[model samples]
Every structure is written in C-alpha cells, then in structure tokens.
Target: MRALGPLALAVLVMLPRLTSAQFGLLDDGLTVQTGREVHGRWASVLHLIPETGRFFPAYWLTYSVIWSVVGTRPLAFFVVNAAVLASLLAMLAHLVRLAGDTRVAVTIAAVAFALSGPAVESFYTLSKAEPLQLAWIALSLLCTATAAARARGSLGRAGWTAGAGVALLFAHATKETSVVLAPIALGWLVIERRAKPGHPCAARFAASYLGVAIVSAAAFAVLRWRYAALPLGEGWYTRAYAFDAATVGPALFRIMAWLVRDFAFLLPLVAVGLVRDRTRGPLLYASIWMLGWLAVYLPWPATFEYYLLPFTLGAAWVAGIVVGDLWRDRAVTPLAWPTLTACALLWVSAGINAAADARVQLVVDRANGQLVDVLGGLPRDSRVALNMSPINEYHFELPMHLVEMKRRPDIAFVRPTTAPGHQGETFLVTPEMANPPRPTVRIALHEAAVRQDRAMLDGLIASGAAERVYETTQRVGILEFGIGRLLCRVAVAPILDPTYCPTERGLIERRTFTYGWQVHRLVHARPIAATMRHGG
Candidate 1:
C-alpha cells in the first residue's frame, strides 16, 4: 500500500499526454503574439483588462516568464503547464493523506485526475486561468493543513498559515471562479475546529485563515467592481444558437443533459463521499469543495466541458475518501469488490475519452505542420502572399514564430493583397482556391478582408502568376463535425450554407471558429501580383 503512492505518481506524469493536441488559436495564438510580436511584458498585457473585462495578471505573468526563457516555443510552455498539473496532484495527495485515507486511495485518486476528460482543456491549452486558480486554492489548503497539524507554537503556526492567505490571494488574481475557494477552505477549518473544541493552536490557526480570506475578499471585490462588468448568467452563448424564447426551456434542458453526460463518471464517487460521511471526515471537505464550484458554474454561461477542471481537486479527494472507506471496511469481504469496481470504472471512463481524442485531436496538428513545412521551405529573400482566417493564423503562426520567424530564410510573408511600393520575386500561398465558396468568402466572417483576399487569389491565377508547387486537402475530422451537430441540437446553432466552403461542418475551439484547413502553395511567382496595387 505504501509503494502504491509513488507508482500512481509515475502514471500521472505520463497520463497528461492522452489529451495533447497542438494549441488552438484564440488562447495559444494570443499568447504567442504576446511573446513574438505584441510586447510580451506585463505592462503591455495589462492594457487588455478594460477591453476584455478579465483581470488575469497572474496568467499573463506566467506567459511573460515563458516568453522570456523559451522565446515562443510551445513545447516549453506545455512542459511548464504539466508541472502545474503535477503540483496540483501533489496537493490533492497531501490532502487525501491528511484525511486519514490509505495509500491505495491516494494512488487511485491521483491517477483519476491525470486522466479526467472534462479537465483536458486546462492541461492542453497554452493560456487558461482555471488550472492556476485550482493550484493556488490547493496550495492554500496544504499550507493551512501543515500549520494546523504539524506546527507546534502559535507564532510558528501563524507564520505557516500566513502562506495559506497568500495562496488564496493568488487564486482570486487568476480567475473569477476562485471566489468559491476561500469559503470552502475556511468552512472546513471552522468545522474541524468545532470537532476539536478550544485547542489554543487550532483557534489561532482558524482565525489567521479567516482573516486572510476576508482581506483577499475585500481586495477581489475592488477588482471586480472596477472591471469584469459583463453580466452573463443568462447563458450568453445560447444567443449564438438563435433559439426562440418559447423554445429556450427545452434547449437549456438539452444543455443540462450534455453537461451531465460530460460529468457523469465522477458524479457517483462525489455522491458516495458526501453521503458516506459529512460529519467530521474528508467527505465534508470534499462536499464543500464540490458544491462550492457547482454553485459558480450554475450561473456562469460558459458550459463547455473543459470548464469543469476546477472541480478536479474536489473530485479526486472524494474518490480517495470513498474508495479508502470501502477498502478499510472488512464487513464487505470477498477481496474488496467495491473498491475494485470503483477503480475499474475510472479506467473504463478514461479509455472512452482516449478513444474520442484519437478521432479528433490530430486534424489541426496535421494542417499546422504542413503549413510550417511549406513556409519553412521558401527560398531566402523571396516574397510570399499568405491569406487565412484569424483562427487559422493561430494554428499556423505560433510554429511560424517559434521555428520559422528566427530564420523565415529571409523570405517576406504578407497578405495576398500586398501594399503599395512592395515589389519582389513573389509567390502566392493559398488554400484550395479551386474549391469555393472558400472560407475567405464566408459572409459570417469579415466581409471586406475576405473579398480583397479572393480578388488577389483570382487575379494571380488568371494572370498565370501562380504556379502550383505543393497542394493537399485538409478535411475536418468526423468528431469535430459531430461536436458541431451537438452544439446545434443543444441550441439551434446556425447552419452555415455550403456556399461558405466545400464542407458544411464547422467547429468552435475556445471561440475560434473554423470550417477546415487545406494548403496550396504557388511557387515561382512572376512578380505581377506583388507589383499590382489594389485599393481597399
């Protein structure tokens, strides 16, 4: 049982790879632009607070640090986020042990968190505030627990407990959802103190944490009042689906079904933990942790599955407590079937998630890689015209900066409609122009930019300036198409006309929408398009 703890950790470090796909454009692209182009410093990043209505100073600072060290390499950022995941697991494991669970329970719980499907986005995305806040909240608990159970003197205990308060402040700095963490941690402390009844050190420890929570709360309220003025409890994304008010009730019901489907695997363990022992056990802490976050998610409009990552800590502890309870109970003998069943269920759910990842994870990665190779191979001092959507820019640009920007082999990259006074031995980079309506021509997308892009591509082809050197079709994965359909059913998502592109299907990843990707490069340009100037 003792050795099980280390083995579970070994598995956790490897399990995160299960959800790895290259970063999407919105978060990853914005993050990359910060480092490679848009001043990556904290001063430049903070300007976004008023515009975006989000105050994520800590999240930006982490990226600035990554940019300072790795210089825009996505892999380096991934490694750092993986370390955050590990720290998160370490804190959860410590919490479970403090709750009096056996090593077997801690081991199972740690492994479950590493493989959680609903928590994948936090692990996979380059920019997210959710994971950071969870780590901060857990660190607070670790500090408080260490102070209460191990520190001997009042001064020593308060010193250790002060660290917990700092952790809570960090959590509030990271995400809006963190408003729930303080009450959960503080409530559990108060409950524990009630059970013990007037130990001087316990009273001191609880008072310190409560004071920290209050200070953090008052500071956070100021930040919220100044910024984050968006009121989104009415399920704002539902407006995108274009549902009638009369039909909204059923649509919301379907969304609830989807959320339940995504969360079903962990639900049972959390339920059992709450029901089994909420009086003075680990179950009580787990209940507060789970219920607290559930309250926040209820009003917040973003119902995406990845948003559930904040609940991973509570879910993990609940699994450990409930399973540990079953493991220690000798009354249900026969080699502990209940404990074995719970473990099997966790693995089975993980298997299902892994299968789903395999189906859709590689689509963007394949296209992004091809785009890099095409751009990387361009001759030095040559001018190239490139046109694609902003989301595609994210998929294509991060690697461009990391792998190609340093070299670009001295080649010039530009939009299809080159500006005045720009002339060179130029080539046009395009995607499946032979097939229309191209993504650039979609009305829902920016109209003026796409029209200029379309005219340039056509003029180049008609003038015989474009000589096709490399071409490949990138199709949207079946799973991506299915997710779009699910979104449509959950709320009457607009059906994009086939006139927009060859494929009727579309998908949204972190609010960056895409139809599909296809790469077609025209080499040995005659400079006619580059020399020609078009007015906007």
Candidate 2:
C-alpha cells in the first residue's frame, strides 16, 4: 500500500508531460485567451457563447481570478489540473479504504486508467472541457459513494447528497454528457436506502438527491432558453452531427476502433467486472451509463476523441473491481507471477506513454508560442478576419470570438455568407466548385447565393460584381471593377483547388458571375489577378 502511494505519485508527476502531444493544454489556452477578452470587456464570438452554466462568468471568473494572482502561465494551469487529478486519485484511495483493501483497489483503479490513452488525452489536453468536467464528476462520485457506505439514518447523509447534487450541476455545466452519471448517483442512494429502512438518513439522502436533480435540470433549462439553444422542437436532424443510422454505423465503427486502440488494456478488466456483477445495481448503472453513452454517440456523425471523456470514471471504477477480483481468484495459479507481470506491463505502458506525452507537450508549447507570435504581430484593435475557425487548432489562441470582424464587412474566409440575402454589401465568397461540404461551411455561402437567385457565374462576373481575375501569385483574387469592393478568399486546410474538383471537372470551366460591386466593367486592381490560395 505504501509502495502503491509512491507509485501513484510518480504517475501523477509524469501524466502532464505524457498527455501533452496530441491535444496539448488547450483548455488553459482557451480560458486564458477568453479571460483576457473577458477582462477587456469584449463580447465573445458568437460561437463562444456558453450553452451551460459551467462556462459562465462564475467559473471563468474563478479561473481568471486565479490567473490574476498566480500569473497566467501554462504552468499555473497545469498545476491546477494536476492538483485536481491528484485529488480525484486521493478520493479513489479513500474509496479503496472504504472497500477494505486499499492496496488492491488503488492499484486496479490507477493502473487501469492512469495509463490508458483516453486518460492521457482527456487530462493532458488543456483546451478540452473534459478534464474539468471529469474532475467535478469524480468529486460527485466520491461524495455519493462515501455517503452510501454509512449506516442507514445517519444525520449527515443529507449534506453529502446535496454536495453530490451541486457537483452534478457543475459537471453538467462543464459538459452535457456528464448527465449520464445522474442515474448512477440516484441508484447509489436508492440501494443504500434499502439497508436502512425507516431511517431518516435514507429519506433525507433521497430527498437531497432529488432536489439536486431538479435544480440542476431547471438551471440548465433556463440557460438553454436564455441562449435559444434548447433542443426542444428542434428535430434530431437539426443537430450538427445527427445522421441517419446508415451513416452513423460507419462512424460508430470508427469510434469503436479508436476506443479499442486506446483502451486495449482496460477493456478486459471492465468486461470481467461487468460479467461478474450484472445484477449489482451500481455496477449495472455504471455499465448502462457507459453503454448508453456509446449507443447515443453511435448515431452522431461528428464524434471526436473528447466525447469519450465522461466515461473514464465509470470505466476506471469497473476496472478496479475487475482487477481486485482477479487478484483474489484462487483458480488463477501462480498468482504472484501474473500480478507481477500485469504490474510490469502497466509500468512499461505508463513509461512509453509518458515519453510520447512529453513530445506532445513540446508540440503544444511550440504551437502556443507561435500563435502568440501571430497575435502579437497584429495591431491592437485590428479588424482581423480569421480565414478559418480558430478552435480547430488544439492550442490556437486567437481571440476570434471577440474580434468583432463580423461587422467590418471583410470577406469572412469561413463560409463568407450568412442566411439568405444576409451577404451584406460585402462580396459573398464561394469556391468555384459546385458541391461543397458543410464541413467547409461553404454550403452556407452557396445556399445564400442560390437564394439570391443570381445566375451563379453571371452574378460573379456582373458589372459592379466581383470579376474573376488573376493575382500576382497563383492564388486567385476576385477583382471588382465597378465597385471598389473585391474579395480574396483563402482556404488553408488540406489545400483544395477548383482544378482538383475530383467529382466534377466541368464546374470550374463554366463562367457565369463577373466580379464587381457595380453594374458593369468598372475598376480593376492595377495588375490583372491570377492566383488563389488553394483551400487546404
């Protein structure tokens, strides 16, 4: 047990370094940037609005206040995250003590998850809300579980239930998926009640849990209503990633593959725990919470790695039970050797993960430094239009939401058009290709232009409309002759050019719209336009 404590400490120390590669410390960067914007009293970008209370001023203010006092360095953020994770570990250790085998429980929980790829990804990546959400979830679980072990009718049970409820709201606000644990927490309270009939503690716990649930749900409803983000009346099809089952199946398969690759070691342990305790309500609740989330996620077309984060706690708990059971099994011959082998495997995996994680940290630091360089060069209060969504980069630090470039009438490289006829006086930009995916947000521009009922090519080439012309480089720039308004759109992802429209070659050859803001051939840049930056 003593050795395990030191081992866990070592893992915690190394976790931050290991998990930094793929995701980087994104949340901190985002929060810090957002905090600066907040301090500056600027309105957040439309996309940056919080749908839940978790990201509201209260939570952000806490982070901002901490930053003000401690200085806004990455290390400060890392320390906070590390401390939260360590506290969760300590809570798990307390649970182990409650279960009466501190050593085995601690080993099982720590080994199964701390070294898993998901844990590394969720905890190490700073920009993601997952770690913070998970921390609150863990705290909630710990509080509820501790209350569950007490004798029925204990006087203090109500407080623990209230604490769990508060934590639940915090978690929910942090991430919507954290709601999956509600049923589990409720079941924990219910099961505990069965052992202490007529006990005031049991009733109070149940009441408190129910109260918390109602309050959290109400608060969320109010928030969503305020933001007009309520799911009500919005068909499932309206969701960003909700797709038909046929499409969802393939995406689900990919997500499953990712899970397998990242969680190979813990899978067996979780399976064993589930198979052995199918009827235990808490166990079943955990399994249901996990499987239920997977089922729900399977139908989403836009599932990402961060979506799998909330399940880490449930998975770790099950893994711990499975490992403890495996250790106690008499049928397993040479138990010492098997246990030692497992430990060694976990240690090696942890070490390899840690090294890889350090490399990730290096990438994140480099990216962050470069991003700061980019922002620093921009003049203060510059009406900068981001050609792309800044959130795509794990460690991107642009104050995109607060830039107020939307009102400046510059070509918003993203989509370049709003709703129908909302293209404003600014020229709406579009790829010459006929079909553009929603992923590019090019659909919005195309749809809007179509709604305007303009002959596509003719509108682009019309007098006062933007004229297609060549630029100095290979990048294409529309030169408006009639009106002084010309738009140059640049795509910077996996570079795409009309020349490579694989599905439709003729779409680019057609000429319809002439570039100009006026009615006829009018003004042109001193030189003819030629080149356009291909969308990456």
- Candidate that would win on lDDT: 1
Off by over 4 Å in 1: 1-24, 33-49, 150-153, 183-210, 220-259, 278-281, 298-301, 330-343, 376-468, 471-516, 521-536
Per-residue CA lDDT of candidate 1, range 53-77, in tens? 5665666666666777876566667
TM-score of each: 0.67, 0.60
Please report, in order, the local distance difference test score of every candidate based on alpha carbons.
0.55, 0.45
Determine which window of 10 residues in candidate 1 has minimal summed lDDT. 435-444
lDDT of 1: 0.55
Question: What lDDT, from 0 to 1, does candidate 2 have?
Answer: 0.45
Give the poorly placed runs of model 2, Cα more than 4 Å off.
1-30, 37-62, 149-155, 185-215, 226-238, 241-243, 270-285, 330-358, 374-530, 533-536
